[model samples]
Target: MQQKIIILDFGSQTTQLIGRRVRELDTFCEIMPYNKFPKDDPSVIGVILSGSPYSVHDKEAFKVDLSQFVGRIPVLGICYGAQFISYANGGKVEAADSREYGRANLEHFDAENPLFNGFVENSQVWMSHGDTITAIPEDYKCIASTANVKFAAYASTKQPVWAVQFHPEVFHSLQGTQLLKNFVVDICGSRQDWSADSFVETTVAELKAQLGDDKVILGLSGGVDSSVAAVLLNKAIGSNLTCIFVDHGMLRKNEFR
Candidate 1:
């Protein structure tokens, strides 16, 4: 089975961007709302907590029960997500006297860590939150920091938890994309082995097994993945396979024209 990554959204503006970034790595990923996660998917290798507009000190701010993933799976938190990580695990975060926003250079980064694998020291990172992580849980260790924020990036040496104050999914983050690639490709130890060619080959065998003399129809989206899937199915079923393209009005400009 193809390994997958799950991004848990917390009402962040760039929530969808995170998924886009992961897909660029030639791997598949899905963004599920905080409440819409599937209960059965062992292939999910990691969970990313998105930043939110809510402050940790606000009584009406969003809250969730993360006990399910704290110690079991790899979890990464960003901005408000990081704060939540600290608070949920017995750390501290409060309103900053001066809201730190906009461009800020990271002071130091642990190059040995996967998050900083391709990142150079004194790299510029995008920051966009008011709350700061003052203290971290006993299990978490600070890996990188800027001048204004002491706990910029942290990870649990004991568990599969990682958090960062910067927006790695944003274009403004100079080395942000590299950081994400390091985490997903290196830290997670994903083979990057999943690809459209593999899918096509696998589906061909599966289709031959199921539809030897039977007929089958595939709804193709003209997408790379779906196109490959269609070819695979066709190779197995031959004349028995039918390809149908459905026209939907929701596609971008000229997508269906």
Candidate 2:
């Protein structure tokens, strides 16, 4: 079975964007609320906790039980997600004098960690959080730090967990995409086998097994998804599949010549 990434959403507005970034890397990724994640899945290659606008210091702040992931899959926590990991694992966080929002520099860093694998000191990163992590869990080692937060980035050798105090999935973070790619491709060790073609083949086989010798009609618009779906159906049911592409009188000049 191909390995997959599981992103535990903590209600971050940017959570879906995280999945988009992962998919952009040609790797299959899924997003589920922290509470709705599957219980047992050794095939789960990695977990990324998304940044939320909520503050972890509040009593009713969104929370996800990390007990199931403590020592298992490689985990990366962002912004609010980082605070959750820190506070849950015996670290300390306090409401900053003010929200630390906007661009900041990674004054100090460790290039060895996959998060900063290709980043240099003084790299710019996007930051937006009211609460800041001042300390980290006892088992975790601090890999990167900024002036404002002593524990900017940490890795737990004992738990395969890593957390960053920045929004690494955002385009403003200069090297944000690289950081994600390193974590997903390098640390998670995910295969680059995820693509439209792979999905088409898998779906075709599954459909054939489920509807053997059954006549089926598959219709699709010319959009990417519909096109792909139509191809899968055609592969599975062959001549039995019929596609309808209507030219709603909205074609570009010379489109149907």
Candidate 3:
């Protein structure tokens, strides 16, 4: 069984980037909209709450019942995810005096904390949110902070929940990948075994078992996903697989030719 990380997307534009970074770390992850977050999954070792464009204070903003997996699994929140965790736990979030949308230095942070194990003091981080966490709940402690954002990051004293007010998925934030590695590898205890070879091997085996001697027809879309699927099918059933490509009139000039 593959160890997995679940990312609850709140419509953040960079939500996919979060999953991409996680996969790059050799850990498999799935991104689902907050409303459709799964309830029970034994393979899920960690959960990530993605940022959103909407404010946590907004009544119509996307919300989820954190109790579903808060204390049971390790959780890391980013940007809006951080504010939502604070706001949900009786903390306070308010519009910032100014919208922070660029690089900021981490003036102070808890070096002893596992989240910042390899992080250096005064390291740069990417910030891009309009709201800031003004106060944290009693059970949560501020673990990191910037010159502008007081509660730039916090960890729950009672639960396995940690959050950051910056965008760690983006490359602009130096040492961001290290932070993610600490969370997913050190804290969550995930074995970095998920890789292209592993995926192909596992997928091929499953395909062979489910499609044994069965002829399969695939639609080739000239895209990465479909092309990969075609390759997998070919590898599984050899001459039993048939591929059909359609000229949908949407291809580039002379693509059909």
Candidate 4:
């Protein structure tokens, strides 16, 4: 089975981008809603907590029990994820005197840290949070700081937990992808073996085993997913796979011609 990275989405608009970045590194990932987070599984090599619109101090803010995977698997929190981690671990996170958005430069960070590997001082990052972590727990050490936010990035001294107050999944962050690569590859030790070709090979083998002599019918919409599915099925069972394409009468001008 391919190792997987799980992302707990707290309703961030950019949460999907995190999964996209991880996939770009040839690593498999799945995004689950915070409330519907899955239990600890061996296939899961790491966990990422996505940002949210609600503040950690709010009564109705989304909550989850991090004890389930905090020490067992590598955890990387972003924005609200960072605040939630700090607030839950005897740290302090409060509203900033002024809202911080757009691009910001890192004032200082530990060059020796694994997350900051290959990252330069004063690297640009995207910030979109209103609350900042003012202090951290005894075991947590601030690793990166921006001019306005004190604890822009932090890691636990005793655990594999790390966090950042900026949106590293966004393009505005200079070393965003590299940071994710470090976590998923270097820190988490993911094999980074997931790819479209491997997916097709495994899927075809499974389909052949499941349907030895049975015939299958698939609907093709000329869209990416359905087209890919049809191809895989055809490769698996050859002539036993039949494809049906329906005309919805929504095609563009001269589409059928």
User: What is the TM-score of each predicted model, taking all chains together?
Assistant: 0.76, 0.80, 0.91, 0.83
Look at candidate 3 and tell me the lDDT of residue 114.
93
Whole-model lDDT per candidate: 0.82, 0.83, 0.92, 0.91
Cα RMSD, each candidate: 4.4, 5.1, 2.1, 3.4
Give one digit per residue, the lDDT tens place, for model 3 in 1-257: 78999999999999999999999999999898897767767999999999999999898899999989998999999999999988888999999888989999999999998999988879999999999899999889999989998888999988889999998899999999999999999999999989978888998999999999999888887777788999988888899999999776678888767
* Pairs with backbone N, CA or C atoms under 3 Å apart (clashes), candidate 4: none
- Ranked candidates (TM-score, high to low): 3, 4, 2, 1
Q: After superposition, how far is residue 86 of candidate 4 from its true place, in Å?
A: 1.0
lDDT of 4 by residue, 1-257 (tens): 67999999999999999999999989989999887666747899999999999999999899989898899999999999999999999999899888888999999999999999999879999999888888998899999988788898999999999999998899999899999999999999989899867877999999999999999988776677788989988988999999988666876776655
Instruction: Write one digit per residue (lDDT tens) for candidate 1, span 1-257.
Output: 67887888888999989888877776667788776656578887778888998998888777778876667677889898899989988999988888878888889878777678878778888899888888999967899989888888999889878899999999888988887887777766566776656756776887788778998788877777678777777788788888888665556777876
How well does candidate 1 score on lDDT at residue 146?
Answer: 93
Give the candidate number with the greatest lDDT.
3
Worst 10-residue stretch by lDDT in candidate 4? 248-257
Which candidate tops TM-score?
Answer: 3
Look at candidate 3 and give me any clashing residue pairs: none
- To one decimal, what is the Cα RMSD in angstroms of model 4 from the true structure? 3.4
For candidate 1, the TM-score is: 0.76
lDDT (Cα, 0-100) at 202 in candidate 1? 72
